[model samples]
Target: MQIKPLIGALGAELLDIDISAPLPPDTLAAVRRALFDYQVIVFRDQKLTLDQHKQFARQFGPLHVHPYILAKPLDGHPEVLRVVKEKDDRRVFGEKWHSDVTFLERPVLGSVLYAIETPSKGGDTLFANMYMAYETLSDGMKAMLEPLTAIHETPVPEVDPATGRPLEPMRLVNKRGEHPVLFTHPETGRKLLYLNTTYVTHFKGMTPEESRPLIDYLCEHATQAAFTCRVRWAPGTVTFWDNRSTQHLPINDYHGERREMHRVTIET
Candidate 1:
């Protein structure tokens, strides 16, 4: 099976790899290497069962479960996360920029998402190349951020699904961390803009007011079109993205329609 890049600009064009079958040795190696280089890879038009999806995800590493999710657990399989958006109950996930499960000390390495049920139109996932975002930063901007650290916190009164109640702050542990302004990827040795608005409430020393402008600026810069890629969903499509070096936003374009996907996040 030969690997073809999907788009002229971004995304991988996978040719003739049966995701339903066991990945061949050479094909698996090629896919792994491509993920590190591209940060986002897509396997188009291969429908696999829930079990097959879980099996393929484990080939990379252990999965990272969402720490704050109060609803249905991943069935003791911490890796598998169910993203379902039904008509009466519509909870859109990851609409904001985020690196998955970054509240953990050792963040998620990557994620594999399978589109189970997709709307006819709309609902695409967007990924930004943090490596490119970092490389293009101005010298003065880099210098200003070198000493800073962002405080990532999962606040109490969580957003509840049923009745939309904000749950009381559970006693939080390992809920916050000081991530460097610039983080280097372990495998590729590439620097990336390491901030996520959802996880990062403020910088270590700066007040919310003081940190707002610069933090917002960097986040906007990191997700600029020049360093970004968008993937439209199809039922059999699977996307594996490097969580350590990429930020993602799931477009909630279809409100009334059902949009469900199965996701497994590899541990970092």
Candidate 2:
């Protein structure tokens, strides 16, 4: 297997490794190392069945089954989590920058997504390099944030369609969880900016008024266009991303077009 870096920021394209066929140990090691360095790795042009996909994902770590969630379980394969957007469904998964499944007490380490069906255009996934996001921070900002902890939650801001009246205010659960604004990657041992605009409500000690400017500035810095890499999908493509060092946004630009992918996440 050969891995080619896609861009200077954070992604790679792997060549000659077929997901359907069993991967040899050395080949898997090379792929794993590339993922650690690039934070996101893409495998192109190989169609992977549900079983084959899950098998490859298992080589990384134990699969994480989301707690407190229910889905139409995929037949015969409990490890493969399905993601589908029907013609009428406007919502797309991963629409915001996040560490996958971080609302859980223990966050997932990484994720593998294989595209089964893709739209002709505009259903891209964008990834940001959190390590670079942290490295670029001013020394002063870094020092100030090192001792701070921010809350993380999974609250959808949308209205409750079931009620005709306006939806009740949604509360961000799991509040007051202190995470360093800067987190160090476990495997690579590199520091990374760790806050998410969607999950982070406020800093630990500051009032909302005090934290607004600092939090807003960090968010904008982390998501700058220069720091992001966008991936356009094709059928039979597989993308594996380390959740510890990166965040992603799935574009909702492909309305009325069918897009489907199966996901398997590694335990943190």
Candidate 3:
């Protein structure tokens, strides 16, 4: 397989490997290495079935089952989240910047998203390099962040997407945890910004109001133009991103068209 850089900051496209079938041992190793090196990797024209998609992701780690999710697991595949946005839907599932499920005690290693159907245009996903975000910070900022821990939570939806049933508070408690602001990538041993606006509410010893300014400042700094890359989607395209080293946002610009994708989150 050939790997081509998608952008200067991060992302690479791997060509000539069909993920529908099991990849050779060396190719799988190469794929893993590319993900670590580039932060984001895409495979085009690989029409992977749900099982095949899970199979490929399982090679990296165990699949994650989202806790108390709004979207139902696709059919019988508990590990796969079938993300769909209809033509008339006002909002998409992941409209904000986040590393998937950061509230979990052990956040996922990464995500494997396979496109089953995509809008004709304008449903691109943007990934920001968190490693670059941490590296570019001033020494004083890094020194301050090194000893800080951010509180994260999974924000529950008001209603279930599949049932339209109003969710009760008892069934909707947020899953909360704490993680260091400057996290060391477990395998790569590199520092990365580990904060996300979606889940993180405050620092360990600070209130939300007290932490807002610094949180906002860091969020703004982390996602600067030079640290990001945009990936366009296709019917058979698959993308994998190292969640520990990146934050991603899915554009909801395809309001007039339908888009469907299957996602599997791999454990670290």
Candidate 4:
């Protein structure tokens, strides 16, 4: 039940508590509170089964079934994504900076990722605080962006010989949506810089070419070291991050080794 802040920016590690067992109402409330207080929370030396993991995450929100088939779900667990990087694979999932599922009408609230097995040297995840990203902007910049809306989009996936084309999450739904460029946190009532490297296409009326300069500048500005924290993974580490307030980048330095993790998305 002890909380240790990992860095000055916005991450913390929970100590002396096992999440596998059923938690009391007050304890669950405290954990949820910590999520808002510190945008990311890491717990080490924990053991949890697939059901146990989902059970704990469901306390926060209903599980999200990912619209894109980026990774296969574990057998019999439709809501859990198996994030595995094989030894021969060149690409690692989530290598760029992004908040989860921004293209959707309602993006997910948070994510809980549990490291099952990790590489010997590197596969850390870096999280940058968007609240800081927005706060640090100049007053003129904030005023200009506060009322603007932006577009978020995901193109159709390429077809493979074996797997086939995958999409239309239980419904052939919208591929693009217009979302407010300036996001206000529902619970905390704080503003955040909502632009992401992956899904954000452009400002509502501008072309991609016209938007690049401002977008590039903001991307470079938001990810500065002062607003970021890195989380190194261990075999039994569990991490929960608030997607509304942070964007994450996964380091793909372990080329020859494998890293396996189980992730659940919380759609509040």
lDDT per residue for candidate 3 within 1-268, as digits (tens), equals 9999999999999998888878899999999999999999999988777889999999998999988557558889999998898887877886788889899998789999999899998999999999999999999999999899999987867765433557775466678989999999998999899998888999999999999899999998898889999999999899999999999999889877999999999997
What TM-score does model 1 achieve against the real structure?
0.90
- Candidate 2 or 4, higher TM-score? 4
**What residue pairs are clashing in model 2?**
none
lDDT of 4: 0.87
Full-model lDDT, candidate 3: 0.90
lDDT of 4 at 5: 99
**Candidate 1, position 18, lDDT:** 77
User: In terms of TM-score, which candidate is strongest?
Assistant: 3
> Which should have the higher lDDT, number 1 or number 4?
4
**Predicted structure with the largest lDDT when compared to the true one:** 3
Write candidate 2's Cα lDDT for 1-268 as tens digits: 7878878899999988787876798887888899998899999997777777878888888998743232334777777777777656666655567777665556577999999899889889999998889999889988988988777666554543222234456442442345778887778888889888767777887786887788788888998878878777999889999997888988888877888888888885
TM-score per candidate, in order? 0.90, 0.88, 0.95, 0.93
* lDDT (0 to 1) per candidate: 0.79, 0.78, 0.90, 0.87
TM-score ranking from best candidate downward: 3, 4, 1, 2
Deviating ranges (above 4 Å) for candidate 2? 68-76, 156-177, 207-212
Clashes of each: 4, 0, 0, 0
